[model samples]
Target: MSIELGVLVAIAGLVISYLAYQLTHIKEVKTDSQENAEVKAELGYIRRGVDDIKIDLRANEKQISQMGERITRVEESTKQAHRRIDQLKGGDQ
Candidate 1:
């Protein structure tokens, strides 16, 4: 009878210790407000970055459009110069 009681006490002690260890190691859960705040902060940063990219993209597009206009002017000038050269050659001939 004495040994049986000792065995039961030891088992109870082990179970209590395991529960204590689990409680100590349990992870804390974040509240919804905290989670939402963090998500909103991250989203704000991403939104700002996207806006910056859009500004840069618009500037790049404008520059590319200006370059195309310049190229068209240059081509017209080159064609005129070629025609003048051909006239000079015919006169020389």
Candidate 2:
């Protein structure tokens, strides 16, 4: 009878110890408000970064458009110079 009781007590002790360990190691979930706040901050940061990128893209696009216009003007001037050279050489009109 004594040995039986000792065995039961040992088993109970082990179960209690396991439960205590689990309680200590359990992780708590973040509250919805905290999660939302973090998400909102991240989104705001990303939006600002995206806005900056859009500004840079617009500036680059304007520069590219100006360069294209300049190239067209240069081509027209080149054509005119060629016409003058051909007239000097007595080539076709």
* Candidate achieving the largest lDDT: 1
Residue-wise C-alpha lDDT for candidate 1, range 1-93, written one tens digit per residue: 989999999999999999987776653234556788999999999999999999999999999999999999999999999999999999999
Candidate of highest TM-score: 1
Give the per-residue lDDT of model 2 (tens digit) for 5-88.
999999999999999877666532346667889999999999999999999999999999999999999999999999999898
RMSD of each: 5.8, 6.4
Model 2 misses residue 16 by how many Å? Answer: 19
| Candidate 2 local distance difference test against the native | 0.91
- Candidate 1: lDDT over CA atoms? 0.92
For each candidate, the alpha-carbon lDDT, in order, equals 0.92, 0.91
